[model samples]
Target: MIKTFVPAPFTTHPALEGGGILHGFFGRQGGISKGIYDNLNCGVGSDDLQAHVLHNRQVLTQTLVGADRPLITPYQIHSPKCLVVTGPWPNGESEQCDALATTTPDIVLAVGSADCGPVLFADADNRVVGAAHSGWKGAIGGVLESTIAQMEALGAKRDRISAVLGPTISQKSYEVGAEFRETFLQHDARNSVYFAEGAKEGHFQFGLPSYIVDRLNACGLAKAEWTGQCTYLEETAFFSYRRTTHRQEPDYGRQLAAISIT
Candidate 1:
């Protein structure tokens, strides 16, 4: 059994600060995973030791909502699906989805990401919270919107909700091919603003955080803001898939962005 554990202080956005909601954008520090996983690797899907991942997740849950409640993060496949969770998944069995919303207090709704956007949502007035994992694929496919829809279904008004995008890949470090940019253009021509010239002639850098927050803001939520921390650049504090790939490492860790209604 895991002993009582506490993690490093996590990042929080002003919009989500101090409410009936307990929320935090966690980094990859203060965990027990070894080697490439290092510390605070909450991804059960990673190649890290199952014991370490489970222990880290338990630490995160305790940090956010105490040890009595459960923290649930579904299997994210870069799709736009969002699940409305009324209770903890049975015995830590997670469903397959990219986002989660809940009216049930004490259940920590979390999303895991490495370089991709980890968005946490809250409507303290309605005692509802949501969390989403939005990679470029999920963002374009509408996972953020899906989360908002579920929140609304649980009595959270769009105008009363606040969302925060946690540490993600910054445009400067996120070079992409022209075909990737075209996917956004085909969806909406105005999305060009999220793309900038990459170092290479045929490549572009994508602004994932900006795009995710923009989509959230367009939903007419009370507030949506990015924590302004880049997972790629903050090597000592966060885990980044792109950074790991660039280094030719075998695997990477995923950080959690979570919210619990109280």
Candidate 2:
């Protein structure tokens, strides 16, 4: 059986309101991908068998999301690109984007992540939803802001949009050299708050989801939250790029965070 993780910190808008449901940050717990990508690896880019990945997605659709709903994910090129999906786009098409938005019911907006942040946004008042994959590049490039604008274009109000960030690599496990820290601080001095002192000399730990939340709040959304789960710290629960590097693994699994209107 597929075990779906539920986001406990977020409150689902009343089902009567026509707003869709958002799932928690899911990890590698239930599919059939073997070796390093074992169990519940939804990333098509991974070396996992394409058939196994498809089966895993099917399991997620039937067990976690309703069987009738179709999940939609973008190509995720770590850019600020956002696509407005009215219906299902081609499945597994690497279209070179990082975000998706839709107002259609039973149309799931999904984002895959190993270390990057998966942000799910919903506006119950307008029945609009969006998802974004926020890596450092995408986040700095304004993917989250672009997603909100796309949702607003679909009739969602900025004040009515609530964004939830799924599990990602927390700061303590995300050590970076001076150049990486300078990249952010040069963009905006306020970004300093998202960095902390790392264990290594002249290095800093970057807070991935914290920056994500800051961007969401700055967009004037109703609420912005993070699940506060660390992918690198929790070996059994999530897949992490840094963790894979530490263990000398070939490739890591990718978890899926999805939301769909019913």
Candidate 3:
């Protein structure tokens, strides 16, 4: 039987493009899933049917790499763990890491996210590429930094690495309690710049994308940019964990951001 495929289109950043590489920030479109997963949900950890998720992943691999190539993503646990992708793991959910880097060709390195910052990195001069999943915890714990280090080990240089942050929750939609603000402040008092007073007395809105971008810039990459797209706001196009929690839904789908050396 022929598997039907919808047009799983994706967005690209100039920083990661035109360097003998494949990169994309995919949304919730052009897949075979249903209900909350709608379409193109590439997360295997979600409660969505395993077959549907696998089908979506198969299509995702075909789109980013080739039908014969592989797409590998880690079993994310919101930590700073990063791995160098030397080969594809037998199970997509078996490797437990939040970020990945590789000098290998033909395999797509990807991370799943819904509002969390999905960061893609490439140093074409070195033929090294990386992908990272950075939520608030991962960001504070240094996942981005870890990813950069891993890529550099594979011969990527900081001055030549181009990083791009894909869709994430914006400040307006990311109100946090005073304790959350305190957490950032404790991590570094200067982090106050990423928070703004929320409507509530003890809450502040957090700027996730900007914070992630700032962290990348601090690493001295050649270029770092946020797509300026908000996953929480674009309901129809992207899946969002925070948005699902707001509506008291059981679970939400996860979009994929991936990169690879051609």
Candidate 4:
């Protein structure tokens, strides 16, 4: 994997600016994988060549933090589980969790997702950071809340933490059946505001990013914003699960959103 092929990640977040912390929302570029995976495919669980996946991970880790620092991501299961990391996990070990929080410097906490929202959190004042894979299920299950709680347990303050949600599928591309809308409404009637009528009957467009940001704000983290990039709509810049499915692709690659305390 050469540097020329890899596009630099789009960095954002007011609290994380000024080199106080290192983070990026990486898309589908800059690696050796071919075919549908293309390049910079960071998902280890994808069926792409394992060697290419490892190389891509190495490229991203080196670019985001440093070649000397360690990068650790969990085996995401869309659960509310959050892990607090003090040190890097051993090679070939992944905890079954949706989010990771850490206070250790140079230890990168990362999460992978294609269509799902990848959230990066930083409490620079407390020297704590976290990353979460927030799909509809994970978001509904309280993954963001759990991540904030875990960060707080590690000395992060709710008011001091800044959360930035990375690129994900937007409402225009996220159509669901009536049952999907009903499920959310059953959880809370207020959640109905997150959905809108679709082009066809018995379907609705879901606003996942807004819902996630609303959750973050409700949790006391005043600073939270989406990058305003839609993975499904931005074909050249992102990998979308719905887009892949609509195209009838065999498999799709996942993107990485990571953060590390300095």
Total backbone collisions for each predicted model: 1, 2, 0, 1
Better of 1 and 2 by lDDT: 1
Q: After superposition, how far is residue 86 of candidate 2 from its true place, in Å?
A: 1.8
RMSD of candidate 2 to true structure, Å: 3.6
Worst 10 residues of 4 by lDDT: 1-10
Q: Report the C-alpha lDDT of model 1 over 32-56, residue by residue, as the tens digit.
A: 9988998999999999999999888
Q: What is the full ranking by lDDT, best candidate first?
A: 3, 1, 4, 2
Higher-TM-score candidate of 1 and 2: 1
Error of 4 at 94 (Å): 0.8
The whole-model C-alpha lDDT of candidate 4 against the native structure comes to: 0.87
Kindly list the per-residue Cα lDDT of model 4 for residues 18-94, writing each as its tens digit: 43688999888777789999878989889999999888888888888655467799999999999998877766588
CA shift at 145, candidate 1, in angstroms?
0.9
Deviation from native of the Cα of residue 46 in model 1, angstroms: 0.7
* lDDT score, candidate 1: 0.89
Q: What is the lDDT of every predicted structure here?
A: 0.89, 0.80, 0.90, 0.87
Error of 4 at 155 (Å): 0.5
* Root-mean-square deviation per candidate: 1.3, 3.6, 1.5, 1.8
Model 2 scores a C-alpha lDDT of: 0.80
Give the CA lDDT, 0 to 100, for residue 92 in model 4.
Answer: 53
lDDT per residue for candidate 3 within 1-262, as digits (tens), equals 1255544788999998876898999999878999999988888889999899888888887777655467888999999999998778965445888999999988888999999999999998889999999999999999999999999898889999999999999999999999999999998999999999999899899999989999999999999999999999999989999999999999999999988777
Candidate 3 residue runs with Cα over 4 Å from true position? 1-4, 90-93
